[model samples]
Target chain A: MQAGGLPDTNQVSTDPLRNEVPVTALGEASVETPTRAQALLRKIEPYLYLLPALLLVGGLLLYSVAHTLAISFTDWDLITPPRFVGLQNYIDAVRDPTFTRSFTNTLVWTGGSLLLPVGGGLLLAVVLERIPGQRVLKTLIYLPAILSTTVVAAIWSYVYTNNGVLNETLRWAGLDALARPWLVFAPTNTLAMIVASSWRALGPSMVLFLVGLQTIPPELIEAAKIDGAGERILFWRIKLPLLRPITAVVVIMSVIGSFMTFDLVWVMTQGGPGRSSETLAVTMYRQAFIMWRMGYAGAVAVILSAIVIVFSISYLRATLKRSAL
Target chain B: MKRYSNAFWPLLVALLLVPALLMGGSIAAQDDPVVIDWANDAAWHEAGQDAVGEASLGVTGIGVNTVIFTSTDTYQAAVRGALPTDDAFPLFDWWFGYRMKDLVDAGLLADVTDIWQGHIDKGEYPASMMGSFGFDGRAYGLPKMINYWVVFYNKHVFAENGLEVPTTWDELMAVAEALKSNGVTPFGLDVVGCRWCSFIWFEEMMVRVDPALYQSVMSGETAYNDPQVVAIMEQWRDLLDAGYFSQPGDFSDNWEAPFVNGDFGMYLIGDWWTGSLERAGFVAGEDYGVFVMPGITEAGNRSLIIEGRPLLIAANSPQLDVALEFADYFMSVEAQTVWAETSDINSPNLLAPEETRPGHLVDLANAVANGEYELYTRYWEATPPQIVEQVVDLLGQFVLDPAALQTVLDGAEQIAQDYWASAGGE
Candidate 1:
């Protein structure tokens, strides 16, 4: 290894665990073997630097996850000592109609997020790329994304309420039939929340797409134009194909975001008109906190996490393997 | 580099040591006036603190620091998550009856039986009040406030419509019809303001239908979808069909605003909301008057729904002696009077002077006494919280679309059945 403590690639590949004698970067100092204590110190130094983060992960994140997992197998009201109920809670969760509704709503949210934010963002980015004063326009569009989730939820709740701006506008436009209590019912409530979510999400998705778009070589677009290709053809052929990598990242993020949707739905609909608009995240919180069924809620959280993890892992693995090739 | 490293150690050590020293200093000074942590979610927490200050004069060396939580859900989550631990507040507000059962069973609540015995012996509180806070033959909490559910009407609106407070089911329907025809939403069924608001009408309707059946259904002796319950839902639906309720979307976090603005002519809620109405600039006798909603049947007419909230002591309180002193002092007439007058709510301590109570409460108390009404627990605390939450959600849907009565009832029944089956019934 180099004396500056930058290990050589060959040295690392050959004997990763072995202590190496280092020559100075200028190759002036003689190589000296590390003593046993020095070798142990070298091994322990990296972990020592990592100790705070390790403690944090183990103490907070991993401990809570492990505790939740343990509680999932029991029947615990907040007040009572947990009674082990085996897989009853899981069975109950699966058989429960509310869980089924929440699961279905989560899927709808995921699909809506992909289409609304990702698809709409790409269109927006492409359009902004051609427009003058794009920077200011982009900032304005992204403003909602910078607001807190609670604020966004509050704003949307006002717009979507029964006698709210949307309904009033509809009535003014002589389109009373089109107006309804946007956050008070089933499909519409979920759809309204998705639109609100999409509005907040569009900014980041657009920025990411813009970054992707700019990375494409100018020569490529010039060549496409020289080949008698129009704007639509260029976007469909070269631009869309090259944008796949960023799209995959955005898609994964949107899917995960949709799965963990609690704040907006909670603040707006509260997963209600009777849990009709609940996502898995809202259901988990309501069960644990509002209903005080810790064990049942644990089962729900585990199910939600398992779904997200499995989807993320499989998608990421596929994307990484393809990207590597 | 060596000089920097030499200085960094002491700097980091100093940073860590300062906080440790401060914490130790605070711990050592615990012998000073003890500040017991009191957690609550009510808007009247300042009034509660005032009452605490008054009570502290009697229970020497102990003052309370009241912590406010913004919502019921957040408050319950915070309190329940910290229970059976020293980290929990030594004093916290909680609902009475079934809501207190789980906490009591877990032994997370201090046994306040002795405190109750003292209050009862002094005739400060009635023995009947103890039943709601008792489990396993021991009282676990002291009454914080008692509120009766009654309809509060705008006296001007009633007079303007040439109507009087309805005394029969038919009269109530006619009043509703008259109000609706006059283009005023006759009722405040603002299910959107809070999830629990959905249960207010469900509870009102249940007892109005039959008090015995209300008890049977709440205790899980009868199915939630039973025909009688369905009949109650049908009656509620008829009200909806008549367009007596303002749309749920018409409500917001400022739940009292629309009622205060005269958008709705009447609101049926706990008498505790009297303070909120007053805060909204409604005079007690001039702007509003309270009346029991006439029942649909003879049994329903005889019953009144009441909500009792309690102040619980943590069993693991570090200052158990101070907590006990606070609890005992809070039950005294002096404390109750200060609490009632300041908070504008009724005190369960019967010995509290009637003049100290709010005029609305006094009038309602007189009417209830004269009518010989049988008081029952409010629906929110009458059943297990799990069932209440699930059923309330279903009821919220029913409010949105009254045509889905059968579907809502079925869903409620399923939830109640699952809970009862698992709990092995009450």
Candidate 2:
């Protein structure tokens, strides 16, 4: 009677356990069960949340890239039927001396902007770390960045004019021999424009570097000091290695911005002094809007985008690899 | 994929939402009155608005939304961008050939031939004035004003220097050399606005070489670097090197002010410049005098470069009847006289009331009728936009560095050849 009672109890417990089931059996049964609204919601909730942004960004990317690419294939003047010309536009662009000059100008501009502004910013951020009144100085340095590009161009135009403040100051200081039409003279015209660009760009990179500098732990510096590392060694090994991500971001942004530069050059130079200062973007605008050659201009735009994308991808890859290391 | 899924529907909705909103707005706009937007240079704002209002009131009895577009450059760009869309201004000021041809080719310009012919038969305007606005024997626009580029020298400066207006090329260069020696730049030029100043030089050179060649070159019949053209460019280079010309600076600098203030000896510009000079407190004939530019050849052929500004109607506009009616009313003697009086512009309508014109303008108008002249379409109007830009930029560069004369000329020739080839040759 006692053994039968134990077996009966086990059977009763086993009934509940059978209903509950093993984890694997439960998983299998759930697959066959008509999923509840709550279960479906659980499955799709994340997707529902992401759907809007994905469609938005995807649509924009598709429209811009596709429209530009399509335009490159057709000789549409914006006022006429788009004549399909296949690869003729690309061939014409390659043959154009102006396009060649613009490509060179873009490369020089990107290289110059990166080396000068980013280098200057890193040096400035390091120096500013120990300097007092940096907050005020930083504000002062950033003032030019706050001004609109047009305003900067206007002020700089006057400064670069033959009879303007720059020449006036040089003449007053007995450097009259150095004074010339700074904006009209070749080689100097390109340099003068770059200087104006650098003035506007310096503060942003400086600010970025300052933020990067702060993210660096004080303990690392103290540890380097304990290891008898000099200030230069601490900066080169500890600080710079840690700041690689920010440096990469600054360099990449400056490169892209330099390639896309148009407004300042348009306002100040109009890609003139015999198209000496014409960049790829300006030439593209002239061809597309002014000359009404949409297909050729689109080809130029595509080439520019490819160049910039290549630079961005390379930079990102290098950054990621460095971070991994 | 999971990350994108959450955003996909919302983004699709938003993407669908924007265009819908824009379409809704556009449809709403359509239900409203057919609003006609008009624009022009700020300098002519008041006169333009008055003319537009008078024309619109007399015809459609509805006011147009007139925006005074600032800066000629900006106005050109805005009109260019808007012309491709159906939202272009119904009527706007445009030069002939360059922009007009593009518009006409695109069928964007309303055929105002019937209206123009009606005005022509009524003897309201001269047939000669229509030459600029007509292409393929059809008029697409109405000429509002005709101006001749005459040399305007400061009478006070010329008298002070004991110089009379030169009548020949040799005498003109002599005056220029003398003016330079006297520490006064012989010419007042705004070369920064490349087309504005360079156009005068181009016209003068073309006239000097051969009037036929000028027409032939502009009509794509002749090369730009012909021996005769090269000779003219060399002469221009010599002038540039001699420092007889004003420095190319900001175009907005008071180019005429230096001439009026006795800082320079002469200024070659359109007769419309007299209005600006007068407004600046300089009296015509007393402070300045207009004369034909000296001839380059001993044949004593004196010629003036004439240009016209015309008003054009958009082709696709639903209000075509109203637009033509407005054009006719605008060309009427009463309106032309009103514009001439207020703006100091020479109305193309020959019947412009004498009382409405300023005394100096009346004299200039009479000169235009009697003078032996070649109507010079704005340089860009005669050339493709690409060639025009290249030529102007090259001219500016030459002004900066005169040593690039041959290179600039060669480049211009190449551009001209390419342009002609593209146009299927003359």
Candidate 3:
């Protein structure tokens, strides 16, 4: 039977009961109307429970990604009606000086962010595992992680100021000529901000490394030690291989975080002294929000997302392949 | 498992309705008490809020909900993203000038012409000032006050060095020379952390070369490499070359001691900077004084760049009526009085008593109406924001390396072509 342009979903099959299996003593029909409804419900119950969550998650995530992609091809200034301009925004970004500079700075930021945090954290974790005062030293290193980004930015700004402690120490050590303004120029300013970002990020990276290292069986290390494996030998041969999974996670996170740098750069420099220290994220922000060029900003964001996805997918595939072997 | 799964669907449906009910209630609530949302950038946040609070007190039972963002960029982002939607504030603090035209063109701003016209008919607001906020006979904003860029000089430094406030370009240069030779920095331009702060000198020089030419450049009609613009940059470079400005800038905090202690003799900036001096315990007239910055050639028009925070009404706001009411109140002399008292600045409303003004602002206003001074909006706001972002960066580059003036101008000219061409197409 039809119901509002669709079939009645609860309709029962028009089959004779003669072919149904018979119960001798109870004499109750096995395929009754109530059981048919119950069977349908049983079949769809799991999906019914999952539908709400799936709709919410898939709806937001897919909608946002789709919208960003669509907006990348349009000329929208947030206030104005969006006009589809195809690949013009991306083509413009390719030649735009600020975009190019930000793209290059993003690469540098990512490279520095990856190496400093991941490497330093790994090395520190290794050293701490063998050291006597592990707990106290761990707390000291982890303390910075708990401090807010604003607090970190303020602390570093003071440390990097021309008359800050760094310069004062340089003067006291008869190196007054060597002291200079850290956040006042290009490349140097970018490097200074990167140092501050890494300082704030290193604590978490070390903690992740420590957690990963703790999961490794001490018995295996002892066994290696008994087999004449020295300190360096053990780290390279066993601990390093064992820590690969966590390292993969750490590297991806650090690289992504670096590409997404805004708060540190904003608080420290605000992408200034001539837009020299701007990263991809900061450029996107300036374009979309400050400049009121939302479409071009979307293009920048899409490029940033593509770059991030490329690195992440490449790393993930390599890790998965290694695991497969 | 059945019991837990059975409860989930109803819960999910209920959750969706909660937001719907709340959203529905919000739209309805806008009709009563005329509760309007106001988003303010930090510069105007404190004074604007105080003025509204005090003014709303005068009008019985009006709720002005304000959210203040410390960073200008953050608040600008909010307006760009949240405007033309129910979520956006009915009223927001904005900059006066070309920004309004763009917002109006995009249909994001309400044409508050009636409110402005009502004030005009009553002889409360000036007709000359209203022209900047108007486009195609429809006005988009209210001219709140004027903050003319002026020379703020330390009185004691001037007295010690036998210097008086210069009346012309030549005299100003001679004063700079005298002060610099005496080991005192002529200008208190410590803007290391904020490279954009250096653009005021560019702003000053642009208006100085020729106010009309500056306006043309701001409107994207003239290129940055225009002979007049080049001359302006060259003059700015000359000032930088003379070592007139103090070294190693203080990053824009008023608490910096150099300007107050008389190490720096003068600062060529907006008159509002006197408030910063006041906050730092410097008396307005005795410790520091202000003067109209002279152009190379006046031609009987001493043009001054006026910069200030503007209050704007969102067209799509649920509380549009009340926002307009607040705008009407905000432009009144009563509100302007409270604003100046709380903000310590000048009000554009003619009805505002002169005694309610800052000492230097009052002097500047007298010069504006009766003397040769012509008040114009700051070029930074006068130009398109997108273009301003690009050209200002070049201006900063010119400051970093004065020799790169030619390069900076060339780059700026290219950026001008791109944005202006796009704007024309639109």
Predicted model with the maximum lDDT: 1
Global CA lDDT of candidate 3, please? 0.78
- Residue A277: error of model 2 in Å? 1.3
* lDDT, model 1: 0.84
DockQ of 2: 0.22
iRMS, candidate 1, in Å: value is: 3.7
lDDT by residue (A237-284, candidate 3, tens digit) is: 999888889999999999999989988887777787789888899889
Query: What TM-score, computed on C-alpha atoms, does each candidate reach?
Result: 0.90, 0.84, 0.87
Q: Chain A only: list TM-scores of all candidates.
A: 0.87, 0.85, 0.87
For residues A114-160, what per-residue lDDT tens digits would candidate 1 score against the true structure?
Answer: 99999999999999999999989999999998899999998888888
**Model 2 CA deviation exceeding 4 Å by range:** A1-61, B1-35, B39-47, B59-62, B67-89, B152-171, B190-199, B248-265, B270-292, B298-302, B338-346, B354-360
State which candidate, 1 or 3, has the greater lDDT. 1
Rank order (by DockQ, best first): 1, 3, 2
* Model 1 / residue A295 / CA error / Å: 2.2
DockQ of every predicted complex = 0.35, 0.22, 0.32
Better of 1 and 2 by lDDT: 1
Judging by DockQ against the true structure, name the best candidate: 1
Q: Write the per-residue lDDT of candidate 2 for residues B1-426, one digit (tens) a residue.
A: 444644766987998899999999988887754456656765564665576566556555645566677666577767766776667777788777665787787778888777777877887766666767868878888886667777888888788788988877888888888888988889876554233355567667677656767777777677777887778778878888889887765222356556767777888877788778887999986888877777776422555576767788877666666666677777777767767777767677767776665566676566555544545565666666657877877777777778887887788888888887887863
lDDT of 1 at B179: 93
Which prediction has more favorable DockQ, 2 or 3?
3
Error of 2 at A28 (Å): 22
Judged by DockQ cut-offs, the docking class of candidate 1 is: acceptable
